[model samples]
Target: MDKIQHQTRPVFPFTAIVGQEEMKLALILNVIDPKIGGVMIMGDRGTGKSTTIRAIADLLPKIEVVSEDLFNSHVSDYDLMSDFVKQQLQEGVSIPSEFIKVPMVDLPLGATEDRLCGTIDIEKALNEGIKTFEPGLLAKANRGILYVDEVNLLDDHLVDILLDSAASGWNTVEREGISVRHPSRFVLVGSGNPEEGELRPQLLDRFGMHAEIRTVKDPSLRVQIVEQRSKFDSDPYSCIEEFQDTQKQLKDAIIFAQSRLHDVTIDYDLKVKISQICSILNVDGLRGDIVINRAAKAFAAYNDKHEVMIEDIKQVIILCLRHRLRKDPLDTIDSGTKVSQVVNDILG
Candidate 1:
């Protein structure tokens, strides 16, 4: 059987993406610290959500992984290695490593549970007296990003599966008492239009951050965006060339931030203020406070700072806590506004 290969296409440079700063910041922070969990991007259609997400792959540095490993297992990080690779290591096998672009996988809305999580080859177990496992999107997304467009429209069960693997950093498949498990750690990025529907609050809270974007209302920015698209459509390579320097700068920043993330620290007063805001807002869990701290540290690292400040927390607090606020069917105030008000009251 012939293998199917993906054709590489020109992605719009992340630096060239106009507006939507919140979405961009959220994505970048997650790259620096995937422990912030992942970003849930809710925006209008044609707002370049997918374009911005895909651009992330090209904007970052490559990763070291075991060559030919389906799970993109890291060479030395036992936490990131797949079960198969771990077994190979335990048996004293030499594992070759290679540098590859960080993976970015798109999850189709119509995909099945088996297609998302994987399938166990029960037939092989019966006929060949051996069990084989088929890797799925989760496996491909290991050590990278998994993006789901129109995520609100995805099946609840499938959403649960993605969230579980994303939260646990592993995927397990069991069939006929045969089981296969692999490390599935990756940034889970979900984008959807709120007009279509909304994820249940419980499911929504699972996301680390929520970024809401809208159609660019500034006329000048709109014109600039349109002209940029026209130029890219006319000459993809030259367009990419135009932003190559900036892309490299952004990539360098991400790599450096990742290396220095652990060095960045947040103050106890800021932590107290963050929790106070969450408490005042009646947030359901500690996730809101924790995400804010991690995101602030990531933002500080990205900015070449050794410590997180009130400013860093201020920048991320809204994104981290907005969606976690208890839903008020009758309240007409924007969630971000509410978060900001609490920030001002507590942090000031």
Candidate 2:
């Protein structure tokens, strides 16, 4: 039998993408701090959600990963060992190291549970009669991003699988007298149109930030977007030069932000005020406070500032905590209205 090789897929360059600055910014901020969690993009179809995510692969810097490790586990100076690896070390075997590029794996809506998680490799296990573990999408996405389109429409069982793997940062499989666990940490990126169906609140809260995108309304900008896309579709490489320059600028900014993030501090009084706002708005859970704090810090870092101000917090409050706010029972009140009321009460 001839061995089939995996094909390299092309991604649209981030810089080449048309307007959607808010969505782009949110994703970049999350990348800067995966502790900020993941980003959820809700928007209309053809609004460039998938395109923006794919483009990120080209825009961001490459990461170092363990060669042949299904999950692209990073080998850092700290050398924090995963449970599986710790056991291996305890057994007195030297672990090998080889560097490979990071990956961005897409999880399609129709993906089966067995495929998302791994099933017994029937061919290797039964046909060849060997006990071998086969990795899945979760493993491939480690130290990288996992993008899901139409996430709201995904099967509940698959969603449960994703949520479990995400929280644990590892994928464990036990079947056919084989038990294996592997690190599966990765940033989750999901995009869907709200009109289709609502995301389960639990899964929704798992996303660190949310960005809503819409079609560009400006006539000139819209035309320019269409023209640029046309040109790129015609000659991908020729259009990439201009895109590369923009991507370089973004990469440089990210590097700068990473260095400056820790230096950026938050004021005690402002932190108190942020808590008051969340409390007044009755946002559920502690995620609101955590996200607001991280967003403010990221905003300050992005601006090359040393401290987070009320203004910085205000600028990011909606993106960070808007979805978490409890809806007003009165049909007359909208989320924006609630946000504005809180902002005015605090800033006024």
Candidate 3:
């Protein structure tokens, strides 16, 4: 019992995962520059989408929070905390803190609006005739990752609510005649197998970047994946131990990127390239332009480079602009392939 409480369940190491370079890069760039927004992954059913995300969540650095702050708000930012907590702090009340691993919350399918965004406490309202607010998944996900699997199958109304909170960074719940608002900032991570269904365009725009994944076609790569998974299933701890140094190196690299992200700058020429690509692709709004700019800068930072290059921009073009393209009524090519061709034509 003690060990379970003190430790985390074993996860497949991010370093041990096979292929899907595009998916892995999108996830890493989000961590480096969350302002690049979140990721929307569409892929085949057995391509390890959910597993890769959960593994990245486990590999992230720990965060420090005020001892009893329910929202897990950063200690320095009082605004992220509740009014009552802020009041206590204003009165010079000493609040201790503890370091805990960053959260990775899963939003279960079929969750009610109230469950996703809290509601009036029913017991309190009935017993004491006083309304009390109950925090839900949105509150718990503050400053963390909020993952939704099979997002295409999610109800439209629920999808709207999630996107609303994500865009506004606040969850507002009015129910049982009680109104409450709280910070709900989080990185939205969603995955779906396209065979299940396609995402709505409005909802699709909410994602910052999109990537597609498929099964490994090479027989040797397939065998390596199976062997690695079998070994981990048999000895999870030992597998983790073996990957420990590699994991630390990657984690440290992410930290380095984050620290110097602001120092990484995009040149005017690269900015023009971004706009030209978006124009040729006919992406709606300016989202494609903006996401590409951010993702490219992040990619350069991840490589320990202080300036964005044409190569950095090229590497992330498909991921940043894939979902933003308005589909052609007559074109027969897949979105990813079309994006690649257009990018090469514009940038080459």
Who is ahead in TM-score, 2 or 3? 3
Ranking by TM-score: 1, 3, 2
Q: Candidate 1 on 67-176: residue-level lDDT in tens?
A: 99889999989999987788899999999999998999999989999999889889888899876888999999999999999999999999999999999999989887
Winning candidate number (lDDT): 1
Least lDDT summed over 10 consecutive residues: which range in candidate 2?
Answer: 1-10
Against the true structure, candidate 3 reaches a TM-score of 0.94
TM-score of each: 0.96, 0.87, 0.94
TM-score of 2: 0.87
Ordered by lDDT, highest first, the candidates read: 1, 3, 2
Question: How big is the positional error of residue 328 in model 1, measured in Å on the Cα after superposition?
Answer: 1.0
> If both were scored by lDDT, which would come out higher, candidate 1 or candidate 3?
1
- Model 1 scores a TM of 0.96
Task: Give me the displacement of residue 199 in model 1, in angstroms.
Answer: 0.4
Kindly give the number of clashing pairs for every candidate: 0, 0, 0
Q: lDDT of each prediction vs. the true structure?
A: 0.91, 0.77, 0.86
Cα error of candidate 2 at position 84, Å: 5.3
Model 1, runs deviating above 4 Å:
1-7
